[model samples]
Structure formats: structure tokens, C-alpha cells
Target: MKRYTLSSLITRLASFEEALAQKMDAKGYVEAAERARRYASEIREIRDFIIVEMTLEPIETLDPMEFLDDAANPEEVDNLRRRVYTKIAEDVEPVSGELADLLRRLSS
Candidate 1:
């Protein structure tokens, strides 16, 4: 997996939002789209970098996203993982039942 610095991730999100807003602007929401585009452009202007690439295989033993915050509890941790994955991954799939059970048990 490719890992990125927080600023880099934020910048990527901003860029995506800006692109979407610009597309919507073509669809006629000129004012709202312009504001969104501006907000996203400001965020994208931040200095950012990708941090590293990691192998998190076996999908069971090693923690895949240990780089994320540790202070969050079980549910928050899961939510954070899901949200970040949704934002960053190019392809995603559901976890197997056994893996899901293992994760739930581990979090508890």
C-alpha cells in the first residue's frame, strides 16, 4: 500500500473536490461551485508529500493502517480506516467473514 503524509492526503482530497466543483460549474451552479473550487484550491496549495509504500499482506496478522491515529477506540479506529481507504485506494473490496470477525475480536 502507498502511504501519504496528512497534508498530501488533504491536498489530494482538495484536488478531487475542486475537479468535481469545476465539473458542476459547467452544469450551472456557478456561485456554489466557484466557492467550492476556491476552498479546494486553497487546500491543494498546501505543501504535501507521499510518505511511503508498505506491504500489509496476510490481511490477518499485521495491522494494515497502523500509521493512522492510535488514540481512537474500536469503532472510531474502524471508521477512520474505512474513510481513509475510501479516499485513497484505487480499488477496494469487502473483507471476508473470517477476516471481519477477526478484526472485530481484535478491536474489542
Candidate 2:
């Protein structure tokens, strides 16, 4: 069995955030749509990365952002984000609240 280190997961999250900053070069209010797409892509990558690194089997996290349509509210977003990370945490090692906390930031 493989031993999952929390540091590695955390490092991966940090690296993802750094790369997100670099890739999202879309500036200003006019380019909001472009920025949203870039942001969504980065989030998807991080979600997939975390799921692959920490899961026991393949998990389908489908874009949580998709749930935040025109009718969705802030409470709905919070609930969806909470559920996604909670489900991930319930799966395997590095199963700490810290891991949950780190994963939660991916959508923020």
C-alpha cells in the first residue's frame, strides 16, 4: 500500500494556486468571461489532482461551479463546496480536517 503524506498534498495545493495566479492573466472587468473560464479550468485541474492523489478509486467530482448558475445562491455554493470536500475526506488517508480545509480553498 502507498503511504500518503499530507505535506505532498498541501504542496500540490500551493503549487496549483501559484500556477493559477500565473495562468489567469485576464485582467479587468471587461474580460470577466475569459477570467472565469481560466479560473474554472484551474479549479477543475486541482480538484482532479486532489481526487486522484487521495482517493481509493476513481471519484466523479464533476464541476461544482456548474451548480452555481443564475438561480443559485451563496448558501447553495457553500453547501456544494462543503459536500464535495467532505466526500473526498471520507475516502482515504491524509484524512484530516487540514486536508479538508486545503481542498475547500480550491473553489475559493
Candidates in order, TM-scores: namely 0.36, 0.35
What lDDT score goes with residue 34 in model 1?
71
Assess each prediction's global lDDT (C-alpha) against the native: 0.41, 0.41
Give the best candidate by TM-score. 1
Residue 105 error, candidate 2, Å: 5.2
Candidate 2: give the clashing pairs: none
Stretch of 10 with least lDDT, candidate 2:
62-71
lDDT of 1 at 38: 65
Q: What is the Å distance of residue 49 in model 1 from its true position? A: 16
Across 1-108, the per-residue lDDT of candidate 2 in tens digits comes to 123344444443344333333333332233433433444455444444444454444323323333334213334434554654455444423444444654556434
- Number of clashes in model 1? 0
RMSD of each: 14.2, 9.3
After the best TM-score superposition of candidate 2, give how far the Cα of residue 73 lies from its true spot, in angstroms. 21
